[model samples]
Target: MKKASLYGTGALLFLALTGCAQQSKSDAAAQLNDQSVMALNWFQQSGEYQALTYQAFTTATYAFDKAQSLTGKPKAVIVDLDETMIDNSAYSAWQVKANKPFEDKSWSRWTHAEQANAVPGAVSFAQYVDSHGGIMFYVSNRDQKDYAATLANLQRLGFPNVNAKTLRLSTTTSNKQARFDAIKNEGYNVVLYVGDNLNDFGAATYHKSNAERRNFVNSNHSLFGTQFIVLPNPLYGDWESGLAPGYNKLTPEQKLKVRADALKAWDGK
Candidate 1:
């Protein structure tokens, strides 16, 4: 009888320890999601965010016009789709509400819903480009499986030239340099590259750490608003993952620690 009772207690203790570990994981995930609340609030609610997008697009228009045209090639502008041309903050907000991490299935469902709204000034800028002898290429890292839905969403938002010819989705790699080269090789004079992430510009910063990204930006500071246009995207991007090596592979608890450690807090006087 004593042996049986001890076995029961051992089993209970094992279950209890397992429950505690699961609870700790759950709390860490929750904390990580909660950290995004302020970023989402600013992105979805602030006029400042809208203003920055408009400014980016407005500058892009000037750059597109100022670019000297080649004798035989058509002018082209390469722009990222998500967060640069269309706003996907609703899907991000849903993650916060559902206490879930970003999953491909959920993102695919959101894309299929065709509920993405256009970023401020994006539609107008695209229309301007289409009308002013410039072709707009929607180059995004979005999976090709979401192609039809993404095309439909862009069309519904009244973005011009969103057909299969102009909309290119990711197939294998997200580096985007090959795609950019393809456009150039097709005899189009690609002029401007626009996006919220540094990687969107080209493969120079692809998978690089934050220090390298910052160096690239600093090295090409003259290209801003001319050769490269950037929109504001604080909610999420490669910048978040650039916080640490193998950041994406880290658990939620480890991620939180990395973020906290990255802060440059001043010592109390």
Candidate 2:
């Protein structure tokens, strides 16, 4: 290998002559921020996101109409927190700004602060549920350690039923079937289930591979706009988590490679 002389001119010439590929590759890599960051920002900033939520709430109101006709023992609306109820995109944007993958510590810090604003139309929907005899249940996977803060956030945002009976947090598992089943056992027929992730619906959607998740959602064709309302959350969800359910076990670069491999590309010549 040839060596450059120990001078600024020689260093400049060496970089210009032999380092084009290395510099370009690194520059490209360094600029590789997560697309979700932009998606989240867009979701928050764009009128289209407002339109999407308006449509979701429209469907939700229609579902409520059906619920009103049911002569069931009790009825409830099950909703997830985070993106479904609270706009935590700022936290997502924070991670993006720092150019880092998600860190639990920072996420905890954000939750502890309990400053997440309510997602658009969420408060109104919850109020509709409360005003019209529908019990509101928030079944979230937010850590139990953050329970009080989470409750505070919910109360701050004026979400109904921030009490013990309605606020369910994950103490052991992220799979919400048991908790949901408990709701059924308690005799509350879930009229509407809402979340950004399909997993918020039940075990059928939980822990499935990315393809499996899509297939499951497709299989339940009519349920989405009727009994299930989904808020848009491009920041993170089963789309990324379903790809490698054991993602925490992998190294950072390995995780990046897995995401890369998961892409479906057109191989046009």
TM-score for each model:
0.98, 0.84
Give the range of the ten consecutive residues with the poorest summed lDDT in model 1.
160-169
Each candidate's clash count: 0, 0
Residues 1-269, model 1: lDDT tens digits: 99999999999999999999999999999999999999999999999999999999999999999999998999999999999999999999999999999999999999999999999999999999999999999999999899999999999999998898899999889999999999999999999999999989999999999999999999999999899999999989999999999999999999999999999998988
TM-score of 2: 0.84
Best-fitting candidate, scored by TM-score: 1
List model 2 lDDT by residue over 203-260, tens digit each: 8867778889889888998888888899887778877767887975665555677878
The local distance difference test score of model 1 is 0.96
The C-alpha stretches of model 2 lying farther than 4 A from their native spots are 1-33, 68-72
